[model samples]
Target: EDFVGHRNGAEEFVIITTLSFGPPLHDALTRRLTEELHSFYNFMERDQGYVLIEDGSGKQSQKPLMSAHITVSQGEPDPNAQPSKAASTSDDPWVDASEDQDQKPDSSKPSGSAFDW
Candidate 1:
């Protein structure tokens, strides 16, 4: 996996590579992963808040398992930006509708069909 950090136009990359197998490859891979995470964490800590821009996975040459990329940018989000109309007007019942009082359970469908036997 590769995690790239961008701050004020500067870019830093951290790559983690691991071989397949259970206990035989565990320690080294874990150590490397931990080191890379700490390095990225320190970089982000120095740069402050960052927003994730992209994430994807694909085949890589060095390792048998597929590789992944995660990109983060230090650019600040627009504070004055308005929500999209489609998003604001969304009628989907599940999203942010926990407090809604108008919804009622349907009585027409049997409640326990799986237990009917």
Candidate 2:
């Protein structure tokens, strides 16, 4: 049996599929298709911004597998938009204190719990 699904958006579509076969063949087929799908996704994400692969080979070692492809388009930002302001010195102190707090949990609270929780 075969199954397919997809989602829609302004610039792209995603398609996924699954196929079934006997246990031995299914395992092998699934493994191969899964590897191919991973490679395909990497290529699409890096090169084409899309993915396309066939799903399922009914070999005795194959299992169920899913495949997908996509297309992406780059959009330009507004030229007239104002650039964001740089953070002031006050903001820097808050950021530094936040990092210090993260490194050291509050000793006033019990070891496992937070003050609010």
Candidate 3:
């Protein structure tokens, strides 16, 4: 299916491309989150019965779906877990193009496949 292919392509691109670092990485993440949120809102708008609770005070209010999900916190990593191979190997998380040339089938084309976002 087209969706599966595109998802695989995205995963491949992330694994092979060095944009995993710095601003480009954050920007890509932001865009993905925004798209997901848009989809969630569209889904919520279609169903009239679904209501999200805004607070612990047991108040029944029609608040935007985003308000109920706005608070985010980073999860602490497990201290006992072993470091991944990539993390253990180098200080830089960016993947070197030379490290795995065969990961990409077409060297002439841009690393990430064409995407509107």
Best by lDDT: 3
| lDDT for predicted candidate 2 compared with the true structure | 0.41
In candidate 2, position 94 carries an lDDT of 30
Quote model 1's TM-score. 0.21
Candidate 3 structure, TM-score to reference = 0.27
Q: Candidate 2 residues 1-117, lDDT tens each?
A: 432322111112222233223344456666786676555345535355433433466433322223533333334569999998766544543333323433444466545422121
* Candidate number with the higher TM-score (1 or 3): 3
In angstroms, how far off is 99's CA in candidate 3? Answer: 29
Q: Which 10-residue window of candidate 1 scores lowest in summed lDDT?
A: 3-12
Clashing residue pairs in candidate 3 are none
For residue 112, what is the lDDT in candidate 3?
46
Q: Which ten residues in a row have the lowest lDDT in candidate 3?
A: 1-10
Best by TM-score: 3
Q: What C-alpha lDDT do the candidate models reach, one value each?
A: 0.38, 0.41, 0.43
Q: Alpha carbon lDDT of residue 94, candidate 1?
A: 32
Give the TM-score of each candidate: 0.21, 0.21, 0.27
Question: What does each candidate score in C-alpha RMSD?
Answer: 21.0, 21.1, 15.6
